[model samples]
Target: MLIVILPDDSRREFDDGVSAYDVAAGISGGLARAAIAAEVDGELRDLHAPLVVAEANGTSGKTAGTSPAARSAGAREVNVRVITKKDPEALGIMRHSAAHVMAQAVMRLHQGVGLAFGPTTATGFYYDFQLDKPLSEEDFPAIEAEMAKIVAADERFERMIVPRAKAVEMCRELGQKLKVEHIETGLAGEETLSFYRQGEFLDLCRGKHIPSTGHIGKAFKLLSVAGAYWKGDASRDQLQRLYATAYFDKKELTDYLTQLEEAKRRDHRVLGKQLELFTISQTVGSGLILWLPKGAVIRQTLEDYLKVELRRRGYDAVYTPNIGKIELYQISGHFPYYSDSQFPPIDLSEREGQKPGEGERYLLKPMNCPHHIMIYKSKPRSYRDLPVRLAEFGTVYRFEQSGELNGMTRVRGFCQDDAHIFCTEEQVADEFRGCLEMTQTVLKSLGMNNYRVRLGFRDPNGDKYVGKPEVWDRAEASLKAVCESMNLPDMSVEAGEAAFYGPKADFVVTDCIGREWQLGTVQLDYNLPSKERFGLEYTGADNAPHQPVMIHRAPLGSMERFVGVLIEHFAGAFPLWLAPEQARVLTVSEKSEEYGREVEQKLKEAGFRVTGDYRGSKLGAKIREAQLGLIPYMLVVGEKDAAEGTVTVRDRLEGDIGAMPLAEAMAKLQAEVAAKTVRQVADGGAPPPPIDRGPKNEY
Candidate 1:
């Protein structure tokens, strides 16, 4: 007999050889039919895998919950939870299986294709194959058609476990050199390996798969294909990566495809060019963002908003150099640790023709905290000045691979709204709580209320983290306590997600499209102030030197990335306060040109970003131009309105409102701008086509 614990903490006894499927069947027929996988003792397993109970006394036996003595003996209790198709975890399992099916289809279509690795990403699954002939978008239909046939066959996925040596022999027999090499290089320590076979197609995998191919349904689609290096090593053989997505329901797939199209339409790169916000030129660098005049305005507005809040919260703004001595980072433990992602050090010796010891080396600062740390150490403090807050919109650089560059979102050079606080241990909780509140306020101010808080703690098993175990524990506990004391959104504790020096709280915001982006972070560090490092200290009431704890935070983590996400979040239609060009004056004809110019001048005098469209163009053509530019308001001064000394206001989305006096129009726009109100544009409403009125209107 085997004792099983259900999800609800209920206990059940079953035969020793019974499987998870049998347990599901015993519970309900519907559950058994819907069961795709099972999570056993926190590890996902095949639904049909036999249930085994291992005792705590280093013994294996067929036993049930016989007596309290059995529990007292420390026998391991088995926990089994059946995963259905509807469970969120089931999507990844299905996607993984879908990759196998896709691979099988590819192999059947194209002979002798060497398979590398097929893994599931956040959005979909991709399989890398080393093929003589490169796969193109044109071949997607054929590959997908083959996948449909395999799905229709509903072949059961059978698993087999074998010795590692035997697995290598099987790979060799199948002419899968990549698999053989992987088994030798990656899995050399494993004594046994598992393989899954469906029909005549066999592959090596560690799987938690659905019972059969039919479970994949007809909701799978093969997306684009791209070239990838083997194991992401550029020097290795290039492989074709075929991307695809799978869903249990057809409607979900349809919705996902629709979202994809909408995402393309809202792409920051495309909108950035059309709206003339920012640009990336290969001549300057791939990941360096060049802020155009309008983009600079948006960035400046964001900085000013954050600066006001920082000042109200007792933060002192400071400036730091773009480049710092390499030794500075070495002392902070940022160098040699993040060296792979950082630009090469600048050699003063090479330029001065001096020996290595005679000259200094400099690095493009990868982080702002070290600079802030130096500033903290620049002054002596008493316990009365326990918490010192320093803030900066510091620009930093990292040498990200060319492939990873994605406009402003993933740039080599970017500015961070970074701040650091040095406080006593007793004040850590309140300081961290303040940072959390400030971060929440920033996100809320921008209409990003739908977000999750993730507490990133150090992984005990990982060697990447610095500081003592006890120090990390205290830091993590302080963060957790602060979170508990406050009412916040859904929060999760994630291990191995913390920075090298400390534990951090990350705010991940979900956009309107249901996609999540990590936008803000607050980290507590005990290592930076330790004696072995920066040696930051303060004098206590007892006249004794004491170390101060440091808190590093960035509510809007990277201004570039924040703005990039904002562009997509609002679809390039900013609110009145944030709009680069708040309003444009459009004249119906030359008869109203003077009135349009006067309206523009009046708005400009009122401290609004306003422009005049005095070109002799049709009123409709001018409106279309303003709408396309996503200007928040268009003040049309037609012949009648010009004579009446009133302007007809057209909201970007709501269109025209009746003529209002100039004073009234200014007040209305001013109110909206002052309140920083967010207005939604109607769905499926495309901007009117642009008419070539003349050269002046050309973007």
Candidate 2:
């Protein structure tokens, strides 16, 4: 007999070889009916799979062979639970299924369409199809309708394992060119292949699909259609990709759609245009942003604020040229490593042939670390000068694929709030802790409190990373020790995701709409060729030259991406200190224009971003316009208030706060600005109130 433990600690003993479906049936008929799949010791599997003998070393050393009779006795345990298709089963399965469904629907509708591959993505799923007739958006509805009918039929999804040659013959008979190609490509080592079938549709797959088509429900939607190269090679065949999304429940599907809509509404590209902050004109080209005055103001505010913080934290700001000679990249080892992402170098020989043998070549800077390393090497250093932090808001350029060019998020040219620290191995822990604290402070100040830390590590088998095994081990250990010592909660470690040079730790923040963005990062690089090529050395107290460890940290990542996130985070409503136009003084009538101008000047003198609304418009219209612009405050100066040396303050998102003396109001505003308070207002006329959200999760 075999005993299986459930999530609720209930155990069911069954005869040997009894499948998970039988266990569910023993629990209750309803549960058995609801079971679509099962998780056998954390590995998701088909419900029909047998519950074999428990393995000795279960996950985490937990045992799976405990007897049900030993209820009160302590024993290592293994958990078994049923999984529905609705659960997140890694996007790969979902995308693969979506692709199968798409192919099935296509074959049913257009008998000539050929299949290639369908894959799941971070957000959704897509399938590629080769057809004589090009697919368009207009065809999505019919395809979706056909899919729905197939789902309603409740056809059983069956899997079969067959010999490779037999599978090839079957595919050839079906005229599935792509399947035959996939087999002939010799990517698989097994003699047998796995195939899935539902009704008249069958395809090659390695699957853990829902038991029946009915499990798909009505929560699927076809999103869009686009053309893609078959294998991402320009010279390869072109295929049409059908994008779609599926969820476990209708409400979840609705929520996803609603979130997508909200995302579109808060798109930086759209808001950037509506606010007249930036632009990317066809005349200039793609992937380049042209920041106008308004955008520049916000960018400057962020840069200045970060600069002040960096300086206060003992960082020395530095600047470097936008372009450098090709040899510099060669010395830095960036040429071969990042060659694909860099713009081709400018060949000066073509222009200056007279200077023979002096054929200088230059390329735009892709990162600031190499230049910062040069600065560190320019002078001698000792143990006393250890932990030297160099910072820069350096602008760099890279050639991003045109298809991947996002508004400000992914651009060709952008400024990084980059910094590097040269420290002894002993100081690595403290320096890393400081970087984490600074990153937390920056995110908190920007109202991004919900974030998690990811420790990215090197892949032992990969040839891309630079450092030796021992060096990589030490660096990764140091970072891990720092994270553990700091007791940082909600931290996860992912191996094989490290940068090409070294291991790193990243801070990922989720926006209000539940979309995650990587805002800050700290990397431990033990092997940059520049350090060796430039012969950098620092003298220890023992008078021996030692190689100082280098730490690369970026609190805000890049100015462009940070601002883009900030725009969406606040929905264009910036805080008082960061707002371009903080307050506007409006007059109830033309008679009070003088008082409004005086109030604006006084506020400006007091170090507030203030403007006067002296337009020939009604007082209510002016107040409404100021609110729409998301100004922090609007001072309405009427004849009575002007004569009384006071102003009626109208708050954004808040209605009104009766007249107050100009000096008192200014003092209050200053306090709010200094405290970085986020004031919320009620629907009716009321004073602005403190934010009601509780203390944020700080770890």
Candidate 3:
């Protein structure tokens, strides 16, 4: 007999080898009707999978497409529960089934299509296929139509487990070379394999599919098609990858689709060009960004603002060379661990006796930590100088693949608002809190209020870390404590997202139109200052040398990405303080041209980013152009206003506000800028309105 425990803690006895479907049916017909898959002891599996004891310490956490890991050990029994569409795992199961339905549709339409792997992603699912002809948007309608017909047929998906020999034979007979290779190599040590059959379609897949094709409703889409290398290897067979998405109901799908449209409307790449803020040139190179004059102005303004805060917080600004000796990275343990993402090291052996990994080969600085460590080590330190903070607007380079580069958000050469704080071990907590406070303060000052704190830690399953398990545990506990103390509303921990050296607290900010971005971060590193490694030390009150705990922080992760995010967050209409061109003076006629010049000069003398449009063009055209440029304030100087020594001020959002004394107008604008006021403009006007984006994809 098998005993199944319900999620509510009730237990029911079933005959041995009874499937999860039977268990759900025994409980209630409604549950049986809604069951998509089942969870056996926290492991997601097919409804038809027998409820049996899970061997050894193996977890049933594996989902569709991942198949099952070797479960040779059986120290305990497996618990079971049915999974419906309401559960998150059910979407994956549904999407996996949807992938099979898509594959079947494609094969039915095309005569000689070869299938590869189809996996479910966070947003959707995609299948790779070796097609004889090219596919495009025009084919999507036809493909979706075929999928609808398949779903109407109500075909059950039957599972078949076979020995390795039978799996190989099946693949050979089906002419699925990819499946044969996956069975032979991908599952190299497996004693058995699983396959599923639906109607005339058969696939080498371990599926937790819906009972039939009819269960896959119309709330699915074939979004786009892209070329993909088989198994993601550039040297392997290239296949056509069909991207898609699915949802439990049409409304969820509709809402998500709406978000995508809104996202497209505010996409930074589109706004970046429309606003002329930044550019990526093919001639300059793929992952490199060119900050135009206007974009440079915004970057400078941000730097100026952050510099003041950094200074107030007791940070000493410094600069580091763009390139350093490769040995430095080796000592910092960044070389080969991060080597794949770094530009190839420059070999200078023939001339300078430095080649590859052996000698003084140079590498473009991939990180700023190593240089800051060297700066601290250069001078002797005592306990009184406990917290040494060095700051830099440091430029670093990484070799981001061409495909992954997206505008300024993902670029090769970018500057970090990087700072390193070296303090005593006892001060780690306070210094950490200080960093958190500083980060929140800066974001608040910039009006970037919607952000969540995430703790990034090392993955226990993989080994690419620098510190011992205990050290990582301590560092993670420390950072987690800092976050808990903050009592943030949406705080969570993300595994496998840590720095190589230690855990970190990352600020993942969501932007307007609902896209998430990783904007800023603060990390804790005890391993970097170890005596066995960098040998960095400071004298304690005990007169013995001890290592100072290091806090690596970047309030604004990078100038390029921050600016990109800012462009979208405000929809290219920056606030008065951050706007590239704060205000423009327009002349009503040639009579007021002289007054407009005087007005522009006065504002500039008062330290405002003001310009004049003494263009011979029409006054209406001038105002329209300024409005399109997203200029915050427009000052009109005509014969009457000039004679009266007053200015007719027009706001970009509120339209013509009214006339005011020149002094009052200047003071009003200045006060707004000083306060860092976040103006709420209407959604659509000459200039797009600013939006409030909560942290996206957060807890």
Candidate 4:
């Protein structure tokens, strides 16, 4: 017999080799029916897999195993519980099964179709296929009907483990070349592999799928089809990706689909065009935003807001050239380290010290850190000069692949709201706190109150990080302590999201459509002060030279992406102050044309961005046009207003705030803009994107 501990700390004895399903069945048939998966000693896996006497440390290296995998199998007992539909994790399992069912339906509908990969996402699942005939939305009805039929048939999903050689043979027999390539290219050293099969359908996957097709209810629908390169490699064969979504219940699925529709309505690219904010011209190049006059005004407004905050925090604004010598980046470890994302370096070997391997080439800057570090090195400093804060709205260039560029959010040439701080060890906490406060202030001012802080730590398995392990450990510890000091209950620590140089406090928020965006960030570092890089330092109170720890922060992240998200967040009906055309003077008739010019000039003289629409149009028609443009206030001047020195006020979304004196209306607009009011809206309730929402891992 084996001992299994329940969540409530109760121990139950079961026969040897008993699976979690057996234990659930013994407890209650209802539990057995509701169970979609299992948690065995903290590992979520197939419910039918044996709980074990003991098992070797697998994917999660949490439990220490003294023996090898061979000896560890069935060695000791572990805690066990059947996972039910109520658990959020079970949704992924069900969705994974839905992918298999989808693949089966696709195979049935078309002959000679080659399957690539199918994986469940946060909200749904998508499968990739290579076929002679391209699939489209027109084929969705037939595909969905076939999927429904498969679910009705109720075939069990069986798992099997086979030696790598045998798995290759099986895949070859099924004519799945991609599966063979995956194993041969990456898993060639593995001893064995696991696969799941449902009726006649089979695919290679690392899975924890639902027990049977029947477990996937009729709450799934195919969404859309898009082009995807094999394995996400542009050089590989092009394939079609069928996007689909699933949920535990039909209502949940309905809600999700409705949210997706709303997302489409709020898409930033569409909104950008509609509002005449920004554009991307092919001749000018892709992923480079050409801010129109209106968009430029909004961006300038945001910049002014940020500048005031930066100064209030004691940050000194500075500027640097767009391109720098390669040696500078080599010192900062960005040249060859981030070469893939950087533009090709320009050769200037003819110049002095511009030798081939001497780091003498000129390249577009990938980041702003190295330049600021140079400024810090330009002069010697005393302990009194500790905690030097530098800021810039610096534009940087990157070589993003063509397929990845998306409007303002993922642009090649974008200006970062970048800054770097050099402070002593003791000042690290205080400086970090200051940056955090600034970040919170920005979010609050923008009315984005719903956000979570993420501590980005290095991944033990990744080689991308620089610096000594002990140094990294201390840096991570200090950052974590700062986060704890803030007493944020919703903050989370995510491994492998760190920047190349150090760990960071990343501020992440979701857009209206439930997509998470990592916006603001603050980082701490000690490695760059070493002799190999720029040895930045300040005289200590002890009169000895001490290296200063550096903090890299960006509360707004980038002017481009910030504006992009704001446009979506506010649905382009900007607040009174930030609106490009804050208020428009519409004439009720030609009789009010003189009054309109006077009202427009008065608002403009008051430092408000106002425009006059004196076109000979109907009053009702002109009012609708102003509203469609999302102007914050529509100031109408007619016979009554022209004669009475009063202006009729109509709020953008609100019908009207009634006729008020011109001075009174001006005051109201000024107060709102000065306050930078951000009215918080419920999730998916964000004034739908005039919209909508990163960088390399940002979006």
Candidate 5:
């Protein structure tokens, strides 16, 4: 007999080799029916996998206060936790199964199809298939229909583990050359491989799949199709990537589809064009954004707002050139390391006006940190001058692949609200806290209240990092200490997401529509100031040279991307202060045209963005045009109001208000602007007044 340690610390006796499914059946019939997989020693595994122990122990009763590993490591026990349909891991298993079902459906519908890998993504799953022809949206319905048939048949998924050689032979026998090549290149190190078979379809995968196809239900959808190179290599064969998503229930799928439609409606590219806020011209470039007057106002307002806070925080502004010597990046380890993502270096040595070897090569600045590092090393400093804070709205460039570029979110050229601080090791925690506070302040000021903090730590087993393990530990501990002191909520730790230099903190903000965007970040680096690199050092109290710790932070990561998210978040209906045109004066007739001009001039002189519409069109047409343009307020100047020294107010969302004195109207609008009131007009309700608050975010 073998002792099985359940999650609740209860002990159960089972014969050797008893499967997880059998254990679930022993617990309850409902759980056995609902069980999709199980957790074995904290690793997810198929339910059909056998659970066994080396020997039987006489141990009985609950094991209290002991770790799960300690109990499972006993001579005669194995830990088993049955996973039901409600488990989070179950969704990932089902999505992987759905990808297999999709691949099978495509094979059944077409001939001579070669299947590569079909993997699950954060949102859903996609399969890359080497097909005879390209597939489009028109073909999705037929594929989904076939997938439905397969799901209805409820075919059981059979897992077969085989040696590496046999797996290659199986792929060859199935005429899947892509799989054979993958096994040869990507899976060559594995001694054995796992393959799953359902009906006439089989694929090589190490999977924790659902028991059968029927568990997928009818919530699966084939969303789109795009061309992808095999292994993401442009030199490899071009394959068709069928993007898809799935859920356990129809309502969940329906809700997801609704969100997708809403996201489409909120797409910044379409709205950018419709609202005339920004443009991407083919003549200029694909990824470069041309911020129109309206968009410029929004960007400028954000900069001014942050600049005020920065000044209060005692940060000094600095400027850097757009290009620098290639050797600078080489010294910073960004030259060859990130060369693929950077534009080709400018070889000035061959310029017509330059002699041989007179000019060295240059590169477009990929990051602002290296330049700031040089700035920090420019002058001698002592312990008293430590914690030097420098900030800039520095523009950087990257060579993003054309396919990956999407509007302002993923662009080649963009400006970063970048800042760097150099401080002593003892002051690392304090400076980091200030950065965290600043980031949260920015998010809260913009009314982005729904956000979570993520601490990115280095992977213990990974060697991609450049800092010493001890230094990395210190830096990570400092950041954690600050976060704990501040008592940040909804925080999570993600390993292997840290920068090459050091660990970092990221703020992932969720918009009103439930889409999360990464907007702010603070990174702690111990690698850049090392003696092997820039040899940056400041005099300590003992008069010895000591390397200072560097903190890299950007509250607004990218101005263009932040504006893009803001555009979608508010649907282009900006707040009073951020609006390009705060108020537009519309004339009731030609008689009031002169008065409308006066009203526009008065608001403009009072430091408001105001415009006058003295068109010959009717008043209704003018109001409708302003409303479509997303103007916040419309001051109606009719002959009656002009004579009374008043104006009728028309709000974009609240409709019309009674006439008020011109002075009173200006004061009301000014108050709203001064408060930076953010109205959620998308939901058709006015939000509460904006209060001046600090970084207290409520989930």
Candidate 6:
């Protein structure tokens, strides 16, 4: 007998070689029915796998010499759970089943459709198919209906392990060219391959599927179809990609669909057009954004505010050219590492008889770090200047795929609020802490309080990184120490995600609607070959030369992406301090026009972004216009208030706050502006005074 510990600190005794399914069955029929998968110790595995005594240090956590009943009573508690013996399967299994069902449905409805690959993604799953004709919305209903039929058949889903040669033969016989290709590449010397079958459909997969097809809940939807290259290589053959989603329960699936709809409504591209903020012209190249006047004002305000904060924190601003000789990047090691993403090199032969390398073969800047490094190496340094920080609002260009191009978030050309610090090993921790503090401050000021930290480290086996093992270890240790010392609320470590040059830490912010965006990043690099190639050195008290550590930090990742996120985060209602037009003065009629202008001039002189509406429109009409514009405050001037040297203030989401003296109103507005107030007042509304109408449609 063997003993198995259940989740609630209970233990059960069973015969030797008893599987997790058998344990679930011993507990209750309902539990066995509800079990989808089993977590054996810390690893996820098939529920049918036998549960043995786990060794002290084995990854599987299994051992022997214990009866089921005795082991159940003596088994230690662990974070493990069992799935249904023969009922619902795991989420991955469900998604994979759904993909098979969808593919089967596609085959039934369309002729000459060959399957490529279908795999579960982070959210759901997608299947690629090579078809003779392109798919459209018209075919979705037929495919869905066929899928429903397949689900209702309740066919048994059996898993079989076959030799790799036999699997290849089966695929070749079925004309599954893509499967053959995958098997040839993914399988090395392994003789066996896993395959799953449900009814007439058989797929090449490594799976732990549900007992039957009917176990798939009625919470599946075929979302859309698009074109994708085979194996994600653009040069390869094109395939039709069908996107879909599935969930264990119907309500959760419905909620996800609703959220997707809401996301479409809040898309920055749509809002940018509706709000007249920016434009992307076909005449101009893709990934290039043309900022309208209002958008330009907002960008300028964000830049100025950040610059002020940077200066206050001891950062010296600097400038770099938009283009530099190709040799600069070659020396910095960016050319070879980032070649695919960079634009083609520019030949300077037009100027004279200059070959590619003879004269400056100027290329557009891809990042500001290389130039900043040059600035650091321009002069010798000592311990006093150990933590020298240089900042720049540099614009960079990259060749982004056309399909990946969206609004400002994924533009080809964008400006980064970039900075680089040259510091010794001893100052790395303090410098990283300072960067974290600055990131927190920036997020708070922007009203982005919900965020988490992600520590990105290098993969030891990957050849992409440039530094030695010891250097990489020290860089990673510095980041980890800073995160721990700061006592961050929530943090996660991810390996094999570092930049080609070094390890990095990212500040990920989730907006109001639960969409996460990487807002800031700080990287530690000790392996830029340029430091050695250029003979960069710092002197110590021992009169010996040593290399300086490089730290690259960007608080606001890029101006374009930051503004795009800010737009959606606040839902277009910017805070008082950041609003392009903070206040607008509305006159009740021609009688108060002079007072309205006077109020606007006074607010403007006091450092407020104020505008006046003096086109002889009604007070209500002017107020409505301002409200639609998302202005934070609207000051009304009328006969009673103007005569008494007072103004009626109307808050944007809060109605009127009665009348106040002109000077007092100015002071209150100034204070709110300085404080960067984002919250509106309570919901006691006020009625706008009546006014005589003038010209129609006049502002």
lDDT (Cα atoms) of all candidates against the true structure: 0.87, 0.79, 0.84, 0.84, 0.86, 0.78
Of candidates 4 and 2, the better by TM-score: 4
By summed lDDT, which 10 consecutive residues of candidate 4 come out lowest?
A: 690-699
lDDT of 2 by residue, 1-699 (tens): 455789898876666567778888888898888787788877777777665645546422334455555434443344578765545562335445655777799899896677777665555567778888888889989999999898889888888878989989988988988778787674357688878899989888767667777767788888888877755555777888788877666776677777777767778888888777789987998888899778898899878878888988999989999998888887777886788889998778858874744788888998888899889988899999988999998999998766457899889999999999989989988998899899988888767787889899998878887757988998899999899887775898988878877889899887777777888999988887224555567899999998888889999998888888877777777778778788889998889988888899899899988889888899889988887787888888989988999998887866798799999889989998787665532112112111112111110
Determine which window of 10 residues in candidate 2 has minimal summed lDDT.
Answer: 690-699
Cα lDDT for residue 109, candidate 1 = 93
lDDT by residue for model 1 over 1-699, one digit each (tens)? 567789999988776677899999999999999999998877788889887735678566444544565567544357889999877789888888899999999999998889888877667788889999989999999999999999999999999989989999999999999899988988878888989999888989888788899889999999999888876678888889898988888877777777777778889999999999999888998899999999999999999999999999999999999999999999999998999999999889967889875689999999999999988888789999878999999999998766567888899999999999999999999999999999998887778887889999999999988899999998999899999888778988999989999999999887777667889999999998899888888999999999999999999999999999999888999888989999999888898888888889899999999998888778788888889899999998888987788999988888898789999999999998877787755232322111111111000
Q: Candidate 5's residue-wise lDDT over 613-696, tens digit each?
A: 998899999999999989999999999988999999999989998799999999999999887788755531222211111111
lDDT string for model 4 (1-699, tens) is 465678887767776678889988988999999988998877887888776634464432123431354235543445777899998688878888898999999999999888888877666778889999999999999999999999999998888888999999999999888888988986877788888889998777777878889999899999999888876788998989998988778877777777777767777899999999998999998888899999999999888989998898899999999999988999889979999889999886656566675546788989999999999989998879988999999999999876668788888999999999999999999999999989999887877766789999999889988888888999999999989999863798989989988999988876655556779999998877767578887899899999899999998887898898888777787777688998899888889899889999888889999898998888889889998898888998889999999999998767778898999988888888888875434346422211121101100
Query: What is the overall TM-score of model 5 with all chains considered together?
Result: 0.91
Residue 192, candidate 1: Cα error in Å is 3.4
Error of 6 at 652 (Å): 1.7
Give the local distance difference test score of model 3: 0.84
TM-score, every prediction:
0.91, 0.82, 0.89, 0.91, 0.91, 0.83
lDDT of 5: 0.86
C-alpha RMSD between model 6 and the true structure: 9.0
> Which lDDT tens digits does candidate 3 get at residues 59-141?
43222322133122222234677888888677777888888999999999898788898877767788889988999999999
Cand. 4 TM to true fold: 0.91
Candidate 1 vs candidate 6: the TM-score winner is 1
- Candidate 3 has a TM-score of 0.89
- For this target, which candidate reaches the highest lDDT against the unseen true structure? 1
